[model samples]
Structure formats: structure tokens, C-alpha cells
Target: MTDMRAAFYDSYGDVDVLQVGELPDPRVGPGEALVEVRAAAVNPVDWKVMAGGLDPLMEVRFPAIPGWDVAGVVRAVGPDIPEVEVGDHVLAYGRKDWVQAGTFAELVSVPVRAIAHKPAELSWEEATALPLAGQTAARTLRDRLAVTDGDVVLVHNASGGVGRMGVQLARILGARTVIGTASERHHDRLRELGATPVVYGEGLADRVREIAPGGVDVVADFVGGVYDVSQAVLTEGGRYASIAEHDVPGIEDRIVWVRPDGAQLQWLADLVADDRLEVDVVRVFEELEDAGAALRANREGHGGKVVLRVSED
Candidate 1:
């Protein structure tokens, strides 16, 4: 009987519901790769799923292993899958339509579409941090809003994992200027990333207007509830997109759902190799059972990515 240690929750509740124990080894279905997880990042969605917030939206079977991001080595490939072979280093946004089990385990089986060669320049934790947040940022700016050169872009919560990625992607896309909203503490870091930093809160619209006096060309809202500021600051014919707000009251805005796309992950990895992008793995919990603590850190809004080092490798 093959078994591996994993963090799982049999019932929906708080972080207390999470438990670490042995589970039968997973099978790799055709077109799937069994990855030996080296590191996995804890995002807000992981705890939310464990707490049943997404129960009505996505199916969750009992004893669900909770996580969506992983950086690891391919241990085996199912028959007919030629995209990746054993021993390949890879990373994935391992999202499934339904939750059965996930990446918070030593070994996770993911479809080929979700697998990308790990960025040559990134460490395991950094690679794990890239998928979910990086994809959200890239998909919104490149596909939904289509930001281009000479365009002024405004990003809400620019210091966060997702917002910071948006700031860098905007620069890579040739935006004339990137304006970011953050607390006073993160303002300097935002400036270092080539963004004009504005303290987030009252007078946000006015502050953004002052930076891009002619009005901004695009607005990417990572923090929700910024509809008013988005409307007030966008130029006529400007585009608006949000990862947190699904529906806006007055305007047509796109709500981004980060999806798993190996090709898109490769694009992000390339940027990392070129040193044009960065993933800050701020905290790492070494034990698998410490996943609960990792979730708590995410809940507390710890700055940058929080990762679980699944193995020393």
C-alpha cells in the first residue's frame, strides 16, 4: 500500500479543520503528470475553499487537499502524455473545475495543460508563487484589457502579489506610465518598480488624476470596491478590469478568473529569466502540517507570497 503525507480537511470550517496524515498514492491519468512537489504557495482561495465559501460554486468532496500553486519535478507521466517527461522541473496553476485533491501534498497529479517548465532563474518557492498571481495579472492586462505602449495604467493595491505583477506586466507591455495605489509603507517599493505610488484611500481618484493629468488609459483593480475611483479616473474609451470584483454597477468591467495555461506560464517564466519580472517569496513554512499557519499568514494579508517548502529539494 503506497501512502504519502498530505494536509487535508474532511469537513468545511476554519484552519483547525486541516489535518496532516497519510493518503493513498494518487494515480496519473492519461495526459497527466505526477509531480513531486518541492514547494507550494498558499493563496487566500485555499482557506476559502476549506471554509466552504466556494461550496456553492465548486464541488468539493470530503478529504480535499487544498492548494492551487506548485513548483516541482515531474516524477511520472501517464500514457499518451508527451509534453513532459520524468525528472522535468515544472510549475502549475493546478486549478480544477471541481475540488477533489490538490497541491498541498508531496505528490500531485495535474493535467499537461497546467504544467510549465520551471523558470531557470527561479527557486522552488518563487516558482510556486508565480502561477496563480502571475497568471491573474498577465491574463487581465494582456488578454482582457489589452494595455499597449503610450497608455497610462492605474493599478489598485499595487504592492500586493497580484497588483505588483500587474505593475511589472504593464511596464513590459510598454505602458507609458504605471500608477499604483498602496499604503505609505509600500509606496517606495512601488516607485522602485517604475510605478508612481499614491496612497490608497480617500482622494484616490484625485491623486491618480494628478499623476496622469490627461486621464488614464487603463485601470486594473486587484483590490475590490474601487469602482468609483476607476470610473472617476479613466479616460474616455479607457478599459477597466478587476480580479476581485465580478460585477460593477455603472460600467462594463471584466472580472478576471485566473486559469491554468502552460503556454502562458512559459511566457511569465521567460520574463523571470530575463530579469524583467520578480517573485518575492516572503515567507516559507518548512513542515507540511504548517499549512494552517501559512493560511493564517495569507488571511492576515502578509506582504508578498507565503509558501510551504514541501521538501528540501
Candidate 2:
């Protein structure tokens, strides 16, 4: 076995349990491609899985290498796969159940369908940050809620990763009004992104109503407890899409599940290439060994996505 440096959690525990050690380098199977990881982004899922919160949803194989978003160059293509060849720059969503090769390693093997061309304009860090949050935002607005140019969309947590992308996607879709909820600190930045920023707090609903008195046509709620506020401002026939758990009246059937879709990712990549979409990488860690620290920092609610620099520069 050719050894590779990987971050692994041998048991369900705190961030202290995560360790950097030698492990077998991943090999591409049929319909898969081996990636020489350049960068990987840490998401909330990484911490949740490490803390054993998602054990029921996804079986935790002990000694799990937990990371989902990766950007790298193809090292090898498995037999029967011709869509990509060795040395192609790519970004991938390593959905644990579907493709378990974690990105917290120097190399990983992902299914062909899970990978997309990395945009030339974006760095490996920026590319790595886009897959999970970017695809979720695009799907929630374009496919699930059917948001259009005339729709008034309210994006909860607009300064966060998914929320930022949602704000931009709403603008691209020609939305008439894009209202976002964030703290006062992020208000100016949201305004720069073409959205009206409302402070998220006790009077969230009233503030949204004041901004869009016509009523919100669609609400994208990434904040867990915003469903009630969303329902209050949503107009008749409006839709509410949430990435977090919400049990609000009249929005029970509007939950958006984040599923990996390569075509949609490819579309976003094209947008990046054309300079239509932008990605923000707030910070990048220098090595996979720092993944645990990154996860802890993200869990503490530091702004933006945290990325790990996996390959030597």
C-alpha cells in the first residue's frame, strides 16, 4: 500500500480525536477517477459527523476520513470512464454515502458523476468552496422553488456560504427584489451583492415586510429557526426552501434536500468561467493536519468557508 497523509477520526469524539497519519492512497474504481487533491473545504457536515450527530442518517465507519468538498487534478481515470483524463483540473462533492473518499487527504477517488471541471479563474481553494453550498443554492432557487425574474426572494443568513451564493443566484435569475437577513456587520456587504439586507433578530418578519411589502415570493432559509418568520412574510402561493430543519406551518412540503448534481455544478463552473459567479474563500489552512482546527473554528461560527490546502504549492 502506498501511504498517503490523511486526517482521520478513529472513534466518534471531539476534535482532539482527529489525527494526521499514513493511510492507503485511494485507487479509482470503474467509473471513478483518482484525484491528487490540491484543496478541500470544510463544511458543517464534517463536524456533525465527527461528533456523531449524523450517525443515523449516514453510517459512520470508524476511522472515517470526513470531508466532502475537494478541488484537484486527476491523477488517473478508472477503466470505462472517458469523460475526463489524467491531469484534468476538477472539483467534486464527496457525498459520504455515494462517494466516501474523503477530501481530508492528499488524494481521493471519486465517482465520475461527482466531479466537474474546475473553473480556470478560481483558485483550488475557491473551487473547493463552491460544490456543496453553491449547488445547494442553485438548486433551491432554480429547480426546487422555481424562482424567476419577478419573484421576491428572501435569503436567510445571506452572508454565509450558501446564503451568499443564493443572493448572487437570485440576482442572476433576474429577481426583482432580493432581501437578505444577516447581522449589521454584513449588511453593507450584502448590499454590495445587490440585496437589501435586513438584520435577523426579534423583528425579522416586520423588517422584511417593511422591505418588501408586496410579500416574499420565495424564502431560502439556511437558518434553522427562521421558518415561522419565513411563513409570516411569504405571500399566497409562495414557497419556502430550507437547508436546515424547520417545522413551520404552511411550509412543511417546501424543504430542500441538498443532493449532488454534476450537471448543475458544471453549469456553475461555466458561470465562474464567464465571470458571472464569484466565490469567496475567507481562509485556507496550510495542511490536512489542520482540518480538525478548521472544523472547530467553523463550528464556532467564524464567517465564510474554511479550506485545507492539501497539496504542496
Candidate 3:
């Protein structure tokens, strides 16, 4: 096995637990492809998993690598991996059932079912940014909320990565008018994305009601603490879903932990290739070693995705 540098955490804690050093290369399992990672996007789950916040829900092995979103070239294929060949550019929501090795590394072993061809029109960073957030957004809108044609959809926390895509995807999926919540600073940008922008916080429901009048037909909550707002503004029998796991009184909304699907990714990639979809890569860390910083930035909640460029050096 070759030696490769990776960002891993030996124990659960703060960013200080992260280590950037050499480790034995991962073994590609049957039905998997070994990818040479060019970029990996960091999500809130990376930091949460690293700090043991999800200990009750997941198993974490020591010296665990700390990312899941990867955009790379297939370096090799394990036995029985007929889906991808060496040298194919791909992206994956390379989440294993358990936490052990991950994508914040020079290479990753991705299941064939989790890999999709990267859209040629997108940069590596942009492609990396899409897997986790984009999938979550797409699934939340399509499956969980059951959004459909002419539905008045409201996207909460709509300035963040998933929320931004949720707004766009809702439109593409035939939402009549998309309402989104963000800070005053992001209102114009939301408007440009074809969403009716409203400031989040107090009286949010009122603002949404003014725009939709008859209440929203669907609510995609990327942020917690908005169940009350959604309830107030959603029409009777309206659907609701949240990417976050927050406790909200009286509303039984779907709490989505999105699963990896290469087919879904391929469809989304087609949209990106057609220029109807865009990924906002707000920040890119040039070194994989700074994965800790990237995780911290995810918690800070920027306008778009945070990514790490895995340096070949």
C-alpha cells in the first residue's frame, strides 16, 4: 500500500484534534473505486462527527478521516467495479455507514453506487461542494416535501448552501413562487435566484404570508427554530421537511439525513452541465490539512459551500 497524507482526528474534540500527516493508503474494496481526490467539501456533519456530537447515532473509529464530499479522478477500480474505469473524473457523497477513513485525503475509496461523473462545466471545488448539500436540498424538496408544479414553496435558512440550492431546485421542479428566508444582506441575491426574499427572525410568518397570501404549499427548513413559522404560513395539508434535527412542537416534519445516490447526482450534474444549476463555492482551503478550519467555517454559516483543495504535493 502507498503512503498518503490525510486529515484525520485521533479523538473526538475541537479542531485541535485534527492531524495532517502520512498514513497507509486505503484499500479499495470490491465494487469500489479508488479516487485521487482533487477537492473535498466540508459540511456541518464533519465537525459534528469529529467532536463526538453524533456519537449516539454513529460509530467513530480513532484516526478517522473527516470529510465525505469528494471530486476526483478514478485512479483504480476494485474487483467487480465495472461502473467506473481509471481516469474518469467523478464526484461522490462518499459516506460510509461507519466513520473510519474519509475524503479529506489524497485518495478515497468510493462505492460505485455513490459515484457520479463530474460535470465538465463545473470546477472541482464546485463539484465537491454539491454532493452533500445539493443532494440534501434535492431530496428534501423532491422526496420529503413532495414539492410539485405551482406549489408555493418556502425555503428557510435559504442563504446557506443547501437552502440556496433548494430555492433553485424548487423553481426548476415547477414551484410557482419560491419564498426564501435570509438576512437583509442576501435579499438581493435571493431575488436574483427567483425567490421572494424575507428576513428571518421575528414576524417571519407575516412576511411569508404577505407574499404567498394563502400560505405555502411546502416548506423546506434548512434551519431549525422555524417550525412555528412554517406552521403559521403553510396551508392545511402542506408538506414540511428539515435537513436539521431540531425539536419543534406539534409539527411532525421529516428530518432528513440524505443518503448517497449516484443516479440522483447524475441528474443534478446534468442540470449543472446545462447551466441551469450553479454551486456557490464561497470558500476554498488550498490544503487538505486545514480541514479543521473548513469544518469551523461550516459552523459559521456562509452564503455557500466550503471546500478543501487536496494538494497533489
Candidate 4:
């Protein structure tokens, strides 16, 4: 067995715990494909998990790799797998039952159910940026909220990575009108993506009401702390889903947790390929040794996703 270079941590902590070094290549299971990682994206959950934020909810093993998004080439497939062949370009939200061998590595063995063909229209960085954010948006809007034709959708914190995807996907899901809440600085970008932008603040509900007098048909909250306003603007019987704000009263059933679904990922990839979706990648860290910095960059916040280039294209 050969050792592969990876970014991992021996114990839970902050970015300082991450180290770039050699680890044994992950074993390919019966339904998995060995991916030669080209790029990986850093999500908020990655660093949170590193700090043991999810310790109560999910089990973690030491020497854990912290990442969930990957875009790569299939180097080999495990036995009984026929869905993807070697040399196929793929992207996935490769979150497993437990966190150990993750996407922040030179190689990762991805379950076939979580792998989707990467669109040629998207670069490795862009492809890597899509999986988690895109899937989160889809899970909230398409799956949970059931966004449909003629629906007027409202996306909270619509300038962030997942919120941006939610805004565009709302329109793509046949929304007659899509209203996005963000700061004034991001309003123009929201408009370009087919959303009516409203500045989020004291009058957020009023601003959204001005756009959709009857109220929004669906509300997707990617950022927490707007539960009051979200409820105020949601029409009676309207669907509301949140990836954040799980602590709010009566929102237990409304909280959405994104899972790895290859079919859903492929739908998002095809949308990007057909020019119906856009992936915003704000920064790219070129070295695996820079993983700590990448995690910090994501935590500091940006308008788009931060990605790590694991291998040259």
C-alpha cells in the first residue's frame, strides 16, 4: 500500500491543528470509486467539525480529514461497481456516515451514490465549489420546500455561497419571482442572477412585502437569525426551510440537512453545464500545506466559495 499526501488533524481544534503529511490511501469499498482529487472546497462545517462542534451529533476519529466537497478524476473502481469507469471526471458531496478520510487529500474513495460526472463547462475549482452549497440549496428548495412553477421564493442571506445558489435555483425551479435578502452591496449581483434584491435589516419583511404583496410562496434561510422576519413574510400555508436556525421554535421539522446524493448532484452539474447555474469561487489555495489558511479564509467570510487545488489539472 502506498501513502498519499493529505491534510488532517490528530485531535479536534482550530485550523492550527491541521497538518499536511502522508497517510495511507483510503481503501476502496465494494460500492466505491477511488478518486484522484483535483480540488476540494472548504465549507463552514469543515472547520466547525474540526473544533468538535459536531461532536455530540456525529462521531469523529483522530487523524481526521476535514472537507466534504470534491472534484476529481476516477482512478479506479471497487468490485461490483459499473456506474463509473476509470478516467471519468466527477464531483461529489462525499460526506460519509462518519468523518475520517475526507476530500482534503490527494486521493479519496467516494461511494458511488455520492459521485456525479463533473461538467466540462466548470473548472476543477468551480466544480469543487458546487457540490455542498448546491446540494444544500437543492435540498432546501427543491426537496423540502418543493419550489414549483409560479412560486414566489424568498432566500435569506442570499449573497453567501449556499444562499446564492438558492437564489438562482429558485428561478430555475420555475419561480415566477425570486426575492433575495442581502446587503446593498450584493443587490446588483442578485439582480443579475434573476432575483429581486432586498436589503436585510429592520425593514426586511416590509421590503420583501413590497415586492410580493401577497407574501412569498417559499422561504429558504441559509443564514440564521431571521426567523421572525421569515415568518412574517411567508404566506399562509407557504413552505419554509432552513439550513440554519435550528434552535427556533417550531422549526425542528423545517431544518434541512444536506446529504450526498449523486442524482441531485448531477442535476446541479447539468444545470451549470447548460448555463442555467453559476458557481462563484472567490479564492483558491494552491498547496495542501495551506489547508489551515484555507479554513481560516472560509471562516472570515466571503461572497463565494473558497477552494483548495489538491492536484494540477
Error of 1 at 291 (Å): 0.7
Regions of model 4 farther than 4 Å from truth: none
What digit string (tens of lDDT, one per residue) describes model 3 on residues 1-313? 7799999988999988888999899898888999999999988889889889989989888889989999999999999988899999999999988998899999889999999998789889888999998999989998777788999999998898898999999999999999999998888988988899999988888888889899999999898877777889989998888877467654554788889999999888888989898888899998976788888888888688999999552
TM-score for every candidate vs. truth?
0.97, 0.96, 0.96, 0.98
lDDT of each: 0.90, 0.85, 0.89, 0.93
**Pairs of residues clashing in candidate 3:** none
- For candidate 3, the 10 contiguous residues with the lowest summed lDDT are 244-253
Task: For residues 259-296, write the lDDT of model 2, one tens digit per residue.
Answer: 76778888888887788887877788898778888888
Q: What ranges in model 1 sit over 4 Å off?
A: 247-253
TM for candidate 4 is 0.98
How many residue pairs clash (N, CA or C atoms closer than 3 angstroms) in each of the candidate models, in the order given? 0, 0, 0, 0
The RMSD of every model to the true structure, in order and in angstroms, is 1.3, 1.6, 1.5, 1.0
Residue pairs in collision within model 4:
none
lDDT of 1 at 135: 96
Better of 1 and 2 by lDDT: 1
Residue-level lDDT for 46 in candidate 4: 98
lDDT of 1: 0.90
Ranking by lDDT: 4, 1, 3, 2
Q: Pick the candidate with the highest TM-score.
A: 4
Error of 1 at 242 (Å): 0.9
Prediction 2 global C-alpha lDDT? 0.85
